[model samples]
Target: MKLLIRNLSRATTEAELQAMFESFGAVQSCNLVKDKTTNKSKGFGFVQMVKNGEAKAAMKTLNGKDVDGFKIRVKRAEDKPTEQPLQDAE
Candidate 1:
């Protein structure tokens, strides 16, 4: 399951984020969003867990939990809707 983590501290790293979720279960992938120009954390990231149960557990425990002075929000990541090309007028 893919989970979205928000409101993270700027100092938080991908390793630290993975560690947090690893306590619950195996983390398939952990990523911290960064600024393209400055290469700094955008204060948010995504974590992919191998199991849905573990993901739910992590979300339940970590959501609204304070980490590094920030109350992080965790929830299932929603897939963005794809935009369709406009049709030509007759």
Candidate 2:
């Protein structure tokens, strides 16, 4: 299960986030969004849990939880559809 985490502090690191979730269950992957130019945290990230039950439990316990003065929001990441280009007929 993929979990979307938002409202994170700029100082938050991927390792810190992973450790926090590891207490609940195993984390398959952890990522923190960053700006291309600034290379700084975008205040959000995604975490992948191997098990659905464990992911759900982590979300339940972590949502609205404060970390470094920020109350983060945790939820299942929505699957984004692939973009397709329009075709023109002659």
> Highest lDDT: which candidate?
1
lDDT of each: 0.98, 0.97
Poorly placed runs, candidate 1 (over 4 Å): none
| Residue range 13-85, candidate 2, lDDT tens digits | 9999999899988999999999999999999999999999999999999999999999999999999998989
Models, CA RMSD each: 0.9, 1.4
Per-residue alpha-carbon lDDT of candidate 1 for residues 9-88, written as tens digits (9 for 90 to 100): 99999999999999999999999999999999999999999999999999999999999899999999999889999999
**Candidate 1 lDDT for residue 67:** 100
Query: Global lDDT for candidate 2?
Result: 0.97
The weakest ten consecutive residues by lDDT in model 1 span 78-87
Tell me the lDDT of model 1 at 42: 98
Q: How accurate is candidate 1 locally (lDDT)?
A: 0.98
TM-score of 2: 0.93
Best by TM-score: 1
TM-score of each: 0.95, 0.93
